[model samples]
Target chain A: MADVKDVDWDAVMADSRFQSLRRKKTIFLWVLMVFSMTYYFVLPLGAAYFPHVFQIKIWGVLNVGLLFALSQFVVAWAVAFCYERRASGQFDVLAKEIVVAFHQQEPRR
Target chain B: MRASRAWSSVILCVISVLVALMPNVALADATVIGGEWRALTLTVFAAVIGLTIYVTYRSASHVKSAADFYAASGSISGLQNGWAIAGDYLSAASFLGIAGLIALNGYDGFMYSVGFLVAYVTVLLVIAEPCRNIGQYTLADILAYRNDPKLSRIFGALSVITVSTFYLTAQMVGGGVLVKTLIGIDYEVSVIAVGVLMLGYVIFGGMVATTWVQIIKATLLVIASIVLVMLVWVPYGFSLPDFMADVVGDPKVQARVAALLGDSSTVMTPSELGQRFLEPGLLYKMPVDQISLAMALVFGTAGLPHILMRFFTVHDAQQARKSVLWAMAIIGGFYVLTLILGFGAAHLVGPAAISAVDAGGNMAAPLLAQYLGGGRDSFWGNFMLAFVSAVAFATIVAVVAGLVLAAASAMAHDLYVGVLRAGRQVSSGQQVAAARVATLIVGAMAILIGIAAKGQNVAVLVGLAFAVAASANFPCILLTLYWRRANTAGMVAGMVVGTLVAVGLTLVSPNLTYPLQKIAAANKVLDAEQAKRTAIEAVLQNPWPQSESLIVKARAEQVALDKAIRLAQADIKKYEGQSRSFMGLKEPLISLKNPGVISIPAGFLAAILASLWIRDERARAKWSELYVRQNTGMGISKSVSH
Candidate 1:
């Protein structure tokens, strides 16, 4: 096991790179979660309570509920795509620095 | 290891030889495939089986260690593992069942697709990377990483076994249903066949075979869906709007919609049918049931044993995250295609035809394929039908193999190694052998359950499995990762309570209880008729009550007859359009079809409260270490070393 005492965990946790990565990831995840949850739950909740709204035809043979459900696929893919971009482009850089520092200290231990 | 490898090769050779020799006998029973494409389907199925066996044979040689058996030595690339994850996730339930649901029920079925896809957000953001970092072979590794290893492993293994068994049964039952419908085999035989094949894959080839099989099946499924969508699109001038317009105008579709709306007398217009089809309330009439279903699906995917196990197959946490994204992309695309195939079946094949084939509309996709290719007796039609059936078969095999592997790992890695051995040094060969034995046992159990559960609603079984998974496993895993004070007691309490509530609620809920009540009512009526006849015969033969007493007795008999008729009439009325409720009750006690919304929170609460009652400082202290390891993917080497 990697030595817990070899590198100061508290110092690592307080590192600026780690903190920023956590903040950005947490914010993005929360935003996507809220958005997707609202978008998803609205159909079932609306179907139960205000099903009439879903009957409102937005286009020929298309209504609010079907359109909304279809849009969710788009929304999910978007969330995944955006998360991947940020994780690889931004978060990985910070994570790699921490790993490198740990590795550099590992030989001494 | 050498002995096992040789044994696996022998098994593969026997299977291959049997497959080669058995096709002729299977083809002679041409009535099984409706006599049109029997030979073609048998050939294709044999070829598919042969290909999987070859893959298994190749993979068997690489099973020199437990790590190789469980996670393929972490050699699968992010992209390949991503496809495998999608393959593992999209069981027969999603591939054929969802499309069938959409074709029959319309807009409400699409809700399942949305919930399933949106679930990846939870997996990717919260579970995937951390789970990959902390765990080696099974999910138990992660849960046991910080707490009392034995207790945590036991609870984790129990939950894994429970979830996987439920899921495996569902997949096995689905396979039986599909084969029975497609190839006209006995349900029991079909179930046994699927069981044997899945057992062979896991026992001999392990994760290596399972992953490749999944990738192959996923690719075929996606391609088949896309081709079906295109076939559907061509009929409407390649325009979705045009297709909807055509569907709205089609007389057959309008009639089907009117019938579904329970207003055939009114003769719904084309526009009205279109509006109803696009709107909700077709299948999921109750909002609460819909909400609960959504909850179960969204959370359930995160807790599925086979799916969680896939994260370990990737090289690192980053690869795991990437794989989740790739799975989302593939799954999202497939769901979108389902929209087309579903609507196409409704428009082209018509609901009456779909219902005629299978009341639950599970045959809609295959029937659509047949229709698109040509008529049922035509070569194109038969070939398309065979291809679709082959794909569905592959889908079932892939999913069941994954489930068996997960269950086996739980038994071998968590139960035997972590608990029984008490962290003792066991050879990798011994561990691999144990996993194979566990796979065989699990596979046998699944087959027996599948045979027993023949003709039961496969969709409800799958839903209940998801509800159990969401309730029992999701809460415990989530809390274990995020909640520092979570102890062994908390984990055990949460899982046990969650499993009990989810299962208990489902058993007493309207889904099962209502149908059972109907059967009882039917039997009661028959018994009452027999008793009434016997009473008349007794009165005629003996006439026990004489004179005034006889008069009173006759009156009493008359009253009894009148009451019986009235009760029967009431039962008939009550069960005319809906299932009979318990004791002729007007409404069920618990109305939600899925118990996730209630059980999930209950589980989390149980875990938290239990932890509050019994705090563990050492576990709490380890949280920082786990957190750091989870975030940066550090210290995973130590955990993976075992």
Candidate 2:
């Protein structure tokens, strides 16, 4: 690895592709974080405040509460899958390009 | 080769000592296992130990540098590391505690399982890739990359040791208790055995052996859970409808459900009992408690040192990301099965029988295994019990090893090398040696504390560990990574305030003892009256006093006894609320058991306000370097193979 001072981090930070990568990654992560946090909190709040709503049975012994709890597992997995796809498919490529471009500019280092 | 020989000798010494101690300890026990099963379970436990030793020796030969000791030389694949992460995260608490909690509390218990899995989402999306890109060995490396190195390493090591030690002791104590109850091992002996085994893994095998141990344990645990779930469903003909029918319609289940409800006047029907059990608010009546605990679970995991260290074991940021995804899948699936296991125990084993063996219901999984295999007298039942017991033992040992490794790294790598010998030339050989010594010390201390805290409530320690991680470590790491203005002052202040507020709130919260002076005074008066009644009853029981004076005295004593009984009853009625709040207040100072809801905001605020209040040119100038490195993985350290 090259020294920190030799890398010209400021130039790399100002690059358009790197900027785009950060923009897209941050926005996608923020959305998922917000959605998941809201969905996670709802389990405790909904179950505690509205017990009767959760108590309404849907199938045999399975109720809305149980279904909602189980759905959290699905939503969490889905979020992970979506992020993996986006990150590996797009973000990783942009990151690789940015690294390669930087290396080309500082070939001596 | 010489070191390998020395390790083998040490291993042999430890094994011989344990073997010598077992017979004396076994004689002292009210052994839980009977007849041939006792020897069978012991043999299985021996096999587990033998396998650990074999793996440790294999990795011991490969551990040649600090990287190998601290991060397994970064050769572990993404999928393998994921299993290791799951192994570290899924402690005995998750396997046994949650299952037992669900069996007893129904929906409320299952709520804990969901939060535990969803916690990984926060780790995956927010923390994983960036952490992998920036950090070399510990979380301190990330902070030191941009901020003040000495300050960051010091506070980082402090928080890591704090979180890991508390968690370590809790797991050790839990292991001792579980082993004693399930397999009838002495508590002290079990704690020492586990502690020694953990040290062997961390000191000799280092991270490589620890990772493999975790992977194998995780596989075994998952397979065992699947088998248990299948057994629970097989009797229902592998149909969900049939299972649900029996769960709600079975007379035995209804009886156990009613017993849990604790309402004796009206006998609730099977369907009604099932509905009540399926609904929430049974164990946690307070909504705030529920929210507070959920917040801690979701955010706290991202800050765990052991979990974060797993990222560095992978080759690159992409592998790190992949590993988190794999962990989420395994952990999520495991939790989902816990729901079935919980209800299965309730229906098949009955809460009555489950709690009868262990009041905490921690033995639910093992007991369920026994029933599923056949019954107590059956051969398969005994085998399943032994198998589950061995798995629980492996789970505890694997988790403690991960924790000891994390704490040892903080001490040796972060504290000794980064802070104590700052800017000094240190050899990799010295670093590895220091880590081994630290592991031995930390592991031993945990064993001692675990034994001393034999019957203490472990829930408080687990809660405090999470609270500290979420409030102290999480904020500092997050801000250092993203906030450009995060300076030395801000980082230090954030950690100090975060840790203080978390611990302070927990101390004042209802999780600890509240002053009940009034109840104590009331109890004093009640005791006096009861003692008077007992004295009068003793005098009245003697019929040999035939004299007129003696008869008169006996009659007077009987009259006094009546008054004493009346007074004692009145006093008991007056102070019926012994557990009422201090100073006659309706609630304690802080009602929330978990302090995340308040302390987490406090931690973040402390960091932001301090950063905005103070300015540092050096920190501001380094932000771009960290940012470029974090986003694009530039200039990150490559894995050391030699």
Candidate 3:
């Protein structure tokens, strides 16, 4: 194994494929994180401050708070599924291309 | 005495078998052994344990190399690894504690489940694939990869050991409580038994055995939960409303609720009962603690060594990503059913019965199982109890094994091989041996501490473990992967500050400190009363007194009694007010039961601020390479058999 300092990281970072992949993943993760955190924080905050509203029954025997809590499970799965599809379909292709380009530029000794 | 002894033996046999079938039960008495349930429970328990041990024996042969020992040679597929991850993550705390909490406190308990399940999204989006792409064996590998390996190794090892040990203690305590309650054994004995079994699995079978055990346990727990839900649902015509109505209408349950509201004569309407159960504020009277707990749980999952290590068992980063989704699906479904189980126990068994069994309500699930089966002495009742208990037991064993493996790897692989040997060319065989020895040492420490911590609430310790993990380990991992400027000094400072603040706050938090003060106050009151009684006795010359002197003494005694009663009432009021405060302070230094709200940001700030001062160009340059590799999975090590 060679020292990591020897790798041409500047060239790799400059590659359009690497930059594109990084941007897509970062944006997707941040959006999903903010959405999930907001959704989660709302339950306790709502129950604490506006509990009477949360206690109002939306469906037979199901209240606003219970519905809100249960929706989080579905939302979490949907986000994960979307991320998986995006990664395997689009990101993987770009990643493979970058790997191939790097190897071609500096062939392993 | 002879009759009672005979009855006890009969109960023991059934309990032992049920103990084999299920690992936890909160209350056991003479009535538990009255019928065919005992025989059925025993038989099922035996079969479960037999199957578990057999799986361990079968997997032992494949663990011939260090890679195999640490990661099952990355032979596990995504789906299998997902179930294994669930098995590893869901401990007695989730299965018993959450359900019990919901039974006692309504909506507040279910909040814990929501926080726990949502945490996986963070794992799926940010940590999973990147962690899998970067390292092997333990979390320390990734932390040390780009920076100074020696310093990273030291900090990583310390954090991993600290988090794992805290988690281990919680699981061991749960195990002891389960064994004592179900099998009627001493708490110390139960702790030692669980510790020894955990050591056996790690020392002999390694990750192969551990993974299989987890997979089996997870499957069993899910199945048991589904069965319990069905049983509870069927009688209520599969309508949640009907089931809840029955719970609200039960005379005993109604009485319990009236007592909770401080009005014995109160008769609550159906809507009011529903409102109380569905809304918060029953358990978390102060709302800040609720949000703080959620913060700890959400960020905490990313830092737990055992959970993080599971990603390595799969083949690649893609599988790692897939595994998190699969885990979320299974775990999410199981939590949904916990509502049914919790409410069912509260309705069918009643709060009085639950408290009689265990004040913590940890036995709600198992007791509910027995009720659903056909009451305590019926064949179905015994069988259901045994099965649930077996699954709960498996839950404890699987979680503890994972924690021990993570801690031992940190001790042997990171500290012994990486730092002490300076990454020397030690044989894989020798490394495997060192890990086994470390497992024994770690296991022994957990057992001793667990014995010492007997009867302490399991929930508090579990929460503290999450806070520590989130504060200390989460920031270092995130910064190391993302920020280019983060150096050895920043990582060390973040870990030290985060760990000290979290642990220090927990020690002084109302949960631990207030209880000690209350006990001390009670002892002082008792001593004062004893001294007063002695003085009164010494003042009297003879056993019998004249009427005039007796009347005079009685009047004085009445005055003292009134004074004492007033003092006691004041003490009770003061203690209630100070229950959530620190050291008789008007307001607590750490207001929240969980310290994550403050500690997590403290960690990130410390890391970022410290990094700004120390510029390491080498580490900064290394970041691009780490980022490229982390994103693209290029030049990452493929799983190789030694």
lDDT of each: 0.78, 0.82, 0.77
Model 1 chain B is weakest, by summed lDDT over 10 consecutive residues, at: B548-557
Q: Is the docking of candidate 2 incorrect, acceptable, medium or high quality?
A: medium
TM-score of chain A of 3: 0.84
Residue B104's lDDT within candidate 1 is 77
Tens-place lDDT per residue, model 3, A1-109, is: 3433345777789888788888987887788889988988888788788888877787666678777888878887888888888888988888889877776664334
Q: What proportion of the real contacts between chains A and B does each prediction keep? A: 0.75, 0.91, 0.68
Sort by TM-score, top down from the best: 2, 1, 3
Residue-wise lDDT of candidate 2 within B495-540, one digit each (tens)?
Answer: 9988999988886677753336444544665566656556546655
CA error at residue A96 for candidate 2, angstroms: 0.8
Report lDDT (Cα) of residue B589, candidate 2. 83
Q: What is the DockQ of the complex in model 1?
A: 0.63
Candidate number with the higher DockQ (2 or 3)? 2
> Worst ten-residue run, lDDT, model 1 chain A?
A1-10
Residues B489-561 of candidate 1 have per-residue lDDT tens digits of 7887888888989887876677764644664675576567666656545665674653443333334344445
